[model samples]
Target: MLVSIRVAAEELGVRPETLRRWESQGKIEAPERTPGGKRRYDLAKLRHLAPHKAPSERVTILYARVSTNGQRDDLVRQRALLETFSSANGWPYEVIEDVGSGLNYHKRGLKQLIAQICSGRVGRLVLSHKDRLLRFGSELVFSLCEHFGVEVVIINASENSTFEEDLASDVIEIVTVFSARLYGSRSHKNKQVMDRLREVAKEVSP
Candidate 1:
């Protein structure tokens, strides 16, 4: 299962330079070279990258995430549950865990998992919940998985009980920020108003 560099690059939907960049960045295992020094990629590896197989026939990825270090134990629990799920299904699995805000896209573990997904080696992905994977626009990622023929299984697909609480937090944070700005903008007028009220109160003898 050996292929010339051009064929391999074409199959990967990347330019040859991209493949060379992948090698340089340690994003992929280096391809072997021929005696005359031509690059060759193992076709098996390339095939594994995006095998057109049914869901049950492919390797799985278990992704676990927590918003902050405070939820490290929750992250562990997520991994544990995913591991159990993967085991029951009898699929070879890898767990990718991250401790960062779901709103963030730059987490190291998240980036690595995406790269793996892009390589097409992952057949399916299992997550405890949707927001555990991201706080917003999770559908974009799901669409990417669909485009790549990767299945996404959210163990809990229903509305989360704490969704309102989380949403409230975001709303409150926004309100508090703007409330401060609203006051700060009229500090001079507000001070004058307060002084007048105090003077009237004194005139009325409390």
Candidate 2:
């Protein structure tokens, strides 16, 4: 069926100007023109432009996360920041919020995000910070996204939080868990281990 330039751009996930440029560069066949000089596109021919899915059908996802409920305010701020950033870019988007340790891979939001990506339902994944996705193995998820043709956008390329800070935090959480498991949650040895880890963390963290 014949469609207008605007509709073609929407279906192809590009601007009408991009279509014009492609035509000029001989990248795509020229569009039909009405007597009034309006460009008309044939949807049948343009399906090749978006081989995976119609770009309009794949949503832009803004993901936000915090390590704990204590950081609920930070999670809220992350959501707001992501919303503002995507809105500024004129992206049609949805925000997914998660509250869990970055070491946790079983977070509901994270699972949902991965599921959507695998299903080819997501066009883009936007994050306020890379660590917000996962402290460890985030690269694996990124690889999955790349395989699925999902674009990953990190809002802040350079982290405001240092690796040492994150490492210390992760160490403390790990020690807390293992100490409890080995020495029992209420055991004095567990307390001592946690205390010692805190002291070492303080020494190493900036």
Q: Which candidate is the best by lDDT?
A: 2
Candidate 2: tens digits of C-alpha lDDT, residues 140-205:
897787666666778896667777888887786666556546676588866786779868977887
Q: Which one is best on TM-score?
A: 2
Backbone Cα, N, C clashes tallied per candidate: 1, 0
lDDT tens readout by residue for model 1, 132-177:
7777767778766755767777788765556556665444334433
Clash pairs, candidate 1, are: 49-120
Listed in order, each prediction's TM-score against the native is 0.55, 0.68
Model 2 CA RMSD to the hidden true structure, in angstroms? 9.5
